[model samples]
Target: MTTKTGDQESPLASQVDPQTSVSRVPPPETPAAVQTRFRVIAAFWAVIIFLGFPIWWKTTSIYRASLPLEEMVHWADGKTCRPVFPLEIHLSTPSLPYIEAQHLLRTTQHTLDDLNEFAAHHLRLKLANDTTGDHTGQDSSEHVNYAARETPDTALTVRLLPQEGLASPRSELHAATTQLDVFYPPSQIPVSSSSNSPLSTFIAAELQQLYGEEKATIAHILSGDTARLASTSPQLAEDISRRLRRSMKYAETYHLSFSLFTPGAEPSSWDIEAAVNEYVSPLLQALSPISNFTVDTQVQLYANFAPTAPKPEYDESEAVWTLKKEGLSAFVNAAEWPLNPSIGTGPTINFILYVPDPSQSPLVVKENSASSWIVPQWGGVFLLNPPLSNDEQGSRSNPAHLSLGSLGPAFMTFSHQLLTLLGTPSTPASLPLRLQTSIRIRAATLLLSASSTMGSLARLTESLPSIPIPATVATSVSTTLSHLTATCSHLREGRFGAALASARVAETEAERSFFEKSMVGQVYFPDEHKVAVYLPLLGPIGVPLVVGLLRELKRIAAKRKAKAS
Candidate 1:
């Protein structure tokens, strides 16, 4: 075994290798190339920061309009307006002289002031001229007739007459008009020396009695505390609460629908036009100043009761068919009844005149044995058991055409129900006076409702930071505030009609603001969802850019270190 020298082994190794036996090492990159690469990276980052990021942000951001948040909150807090009622009562004393009448007016006002406890609602008395064609107190009847006409801003008229037959002072309130007839003995008239007299005391007490329920109701509505109102009786408070609950919400208009429903087919035609024209048209006209009403009537046959409704049973003792009181609630078959609300902005009031089948004639509510009942806010129902037609087989059948006379009682009941549903006070025995009361009640209700809506909107905005309020909501808020202010001014100036109109607008605007569609709609995107959606695109593009940036920064740091060394 001979070991070869290292030089000779290297020659053999070189011959064994391929033709290219030499390995070459490349030179370092030039500064121009390094600067070009760094510039490319910098340009990419600049585009991302200036253009790409802004586009993404603009596309994803929500659009929120500017709002007067502070002003809205203030209005909601009831800091914007306070409501006050100043009722003007006109005194027409045709019997007394001018000086005596003025003295009586002053004394009565003083008496009323002393008796009244609630300051917000107080009465003001003004004397109406008793000049009815010459002699005073000579034509008392003519004077009363003249005074009954529509007096401007007048709530009530007092007609004083001196009667020789009267033992004591007597007061009679007119059921039709806002007039009070006071018949007194001539001796009871107030003299100049007497500050307090029997006549003044009587008038004061009468006025107090007239407005007692109204004052309590106003107080309850304003404060919502019945216990604090001293004049409110338990029964009165319960009545007020029931009326409020049963009454329909205040509206600018109401659609009154008179429908005749029957289980059989005989009573298909009715004198509805005549009935509405005679009985309902007058009432609707009377209520026109408060709310506009559209009258429509219909007749529906083959209308059956719901399955859940209790079946009417024959009362052998009373000889009539009767339905249980609790079952009256289900008398109207809501599922099958064609009682859809009228096409309008306001609500529809349905007056259902149900005529039971001849077999179930004389149907009445079991508890009260009554033929009429109110559905509380919805409308009213009247069971009319028309006399059956006589036939050879003695089979019972309703008449084909109902007369105007037959519909009188039903329509009257409907009118009363309409009044109740409109939140009219039960007292005062005057339609005009009751309407005025309704105006005040409706105004108060609208004001409070708007205030509550404003507060709710404010709280909602505070609670939900993500919801984007549209400019419409701000516009609605501003309108509501302006109308509320106008309403307060109208009430103060005794323009109740205008006040009601303003309150209606305020309520409508507040509701619009609170229930704004855009403000209510909010699409919530969770952080996890955001990450899931963005990660796929960002992950692919971000890693390379970040790594390149970090590597470039490290290289620059190393260069600085070398230069320092």
Candidate 2:
């Protein structure tokens, strides 16, 4: 009953009882087995460090290219290009003797030099060939080519005509050509002995007056303040500021889209081809030397006003539908109207010829009671209220097709708006002269714009250290710098047209570099996303490797202690 006193058991029973039998212990590890485990662990770490880690790094890393950051910043700071405009004015003395003409030129040059305070924009008077003839009364075609060939950058030509009827010198600027006519009384002519004469003084005064605004504008743009560079009247400064604010940015090309918009079904077609040919083609041709233009036209029906737009109301005093002057900005139903910009590298100018519904007939701006107005850099808007159709119901509807004659006035306004939007100066009655002035203005504007853009890009890179800059951005920056340098050189050499072309390239490249899609896309990857993607794989693999490394280290330390004992 006592089970033979627990210790007194048979050999077989003792063997069956696991506690009394010898315990099964694992054998000590062989040197080869320990070496094999060590090799396996080392292999795992080697694969991680040399292969897996490198692959992950290559896949996840961003690509950045070297850039000339200092150079770009310098260009933006206006430290690189100090723009100088040495305008060359040709003096044509058809009536004066050679020595007398030279004497007048000397005296006038001295007077002009004395009057000019802006050294960068001073006029350089040069004598024109006598054979070019008096271009004052003649057509521009008669002398433009000859003058262009002889003197490449002649801003204006002064034709001296001695008249018996004139008591004092009277100057006239041609409306089409770059010629200025000075009809002088014979007595006002400068004698060889006289250092200064009335004619020279008059010419100097007229020249100053003609270029006064231009000088102010250039100075304002260069110095960023007219008050700092020269003494500019408040009125002139205000006008310049207004014009600059209203003008469009400089571009290599401009798309002119003339659209006929109507809320109703009528006025579905227009003689836009003929209208453009007659009114806009010549101006575009004249502007071809500075920039290219693409002309297109369309007629859109059922184009209603936006929901938030101000509706025209009947004016009691004028007995017409009138829109408030303040609300004119929202007159164009941009949401409903198909005023998409023309597809091109340059900007698209939209000229909307809106035909109001019969209910809002004779719609005009309330304050001025005008039918047309310029929308700053956008375009122009004109309200055309066509006469009602003669029907049994007497429905008020616009004509299906607008004739060229009917479209003339609207197109004329559009042309003038186009000129203003292109940053053409209002002064100087000559069209060619205005175009030249526009060229200079555009050049100056583009140069400053590109410089500013470069500065902005440099600052952007410095501010956002995590944003990856691509090789294309570096390439674009280089191209911009090179073209900007070329533009400055061209301006210095009086090649304004060439300068504009180069500046266009520089601006395009600069904008492209600054707005690169890839660079922008790289900046938005969040830290949460990175952790979610990497933690699962790294956690499992790292724990085992670290534990194995620690166990091996502990074993080696114990072995060294045993050896030391």
Candidate 3:
């Protein structure tokens, strides 16, 4: 009803206020506020760049010590060291004049040099100097002992003697020592003007034949080319290959554990101590020069076979129980047997003497009726078939305790097995020479093994960039290389004992460096996992900071454009 101007104005004002509320704009930001926002963002980015990033990098970076990678690789590739064997032979001609001895030595050396095909192995003959000068009735051993103390490089001593009515020259190698006795006619002695003689030729040929197997074996190991060993027969090569395949790796010390495992309760105890002393002690003593050994014995009864193993079947034709040849691998009940290795740093060779129950007495391999077998680098096993006897109740059973006489055959087999496991060659009949061969073999094996480990470590570091290499590993590598050098030098100089010692050090250091526990931790924590862990925390904070920075940069750019216009 009141059509006044105030009422009309009020309604329009209300309509205008609604429009203004719908389309309103805030006030422009002051330069101080913009500068403050920019400062805040710049400060945040500065903290992240200077403090947080450095802390993260410092905490996450891996330590990698500088290594002689090239030198290691060269050594592994056989470029740094070429192994050589310089065997020294002493000529002890107590029955001949010095001039004649020197002439014979010259002729023999000439012939030896001509016969030797492998340059890596050469023998040098030196005349023995008789310092005592009293050769009336001194034992040969005494002279040998004195010479040994004088010069340890004497590999073999040749004692030349003139015998009565000898048609030709003949050599007899001493089994109890490292001397070769040669008997020849008095007229066969070489003159100084003579370039060669029949006696010299015979001695040279004998020496060559004696070291033929060793030379071929070394050639095979160094080159792996059987063609280089043309002097060796195919059968001999195959035998050497098989022996190498079957032999255990080199170690400074070895633990020999003799255990008597039986399926039944009887035959629990054995004369292991006496048997070992009789059969194994001499071998261990002989091998002490190459490696140290610790002997231990134990007895386990009622050691049943594994459930998954094949059961022995009774053959009526043979009237005995037999195990399948293929099933011998599972015959040892590892779970039930207490054949644990002895506490030591080196490997343990376990020899188990298993006795079957009365019902399954005289167990033999079905294929060939063999009673003993080798586990191939593990150990040996012997099946003991004791003579059955009647108990008080007239029940036939195995003896309760094995006597020393009853254990003789088994211990002898174990001794042979031990020698085989140690990679002893079957020739020359001289135990000392065989042991010397073992020393060289062990040195070579350790050198190659350590070299292989070094190569593997180098490749591992290259392939896995994230793995941390500790300083200890570096030190170990250095030690290994140094010892490897010394080993090579010792081998070149024919000091096999020193070579073995240096190689032991090399092998130990190489193993320690390659098996470093700290190097394996990074393999489980990868870069993707790191990204996943950090993304959530960084994403929320990073987005706002980045957006503020971009906006500030755009505003400054626009202000500069305006000023330029």
lDDT agreement with native, every candidate = 0.85, 0.86, 0.87
lDDT of 2 by residue, 362-460 (tens): 788888889999899888898887776765687666678788888999999999999988888888777888898888887888899899999999998
Give candidate 1 regions above 4 Å deviation.
1-29, 129-152, 523-532, 550-565
Clash pairs detected, candidate 2: none
Q: Pairs clashing in candidate 1? A: none
Q: Which of the two candidates, 1 or 2, achieves a greater TM-score against the reference?
A: 1
Q: How close is every model to the real structure, measured as TM-score?
A: 0.87, 0.84, 0.88
Pairs that clash in candidate 3? none
Scanning candidate 1 in windows of ten residues, the lowest lDDT window is 144-153
What lDDT score goes with residue 520 in model 3? Answer: 92
Those runs of model 2 whose alpha carbons end farther than 4 Å from true positions after fitting are 1-27, 130-152, 191-194, 229-231, 262-269, 300-321, 341-346, 355-362, 385-401, 526-532, 550-565
lDDT of 3: 0.87
lDDT ranking from best candidate downward: 3, 2, 1
Candidate 1 residue 445 Cα shift, in angstroms, is 0.5
Q: Under the 3 Å rule for N, CA and C atoms, how many clashes does model 2 have?
A: 0
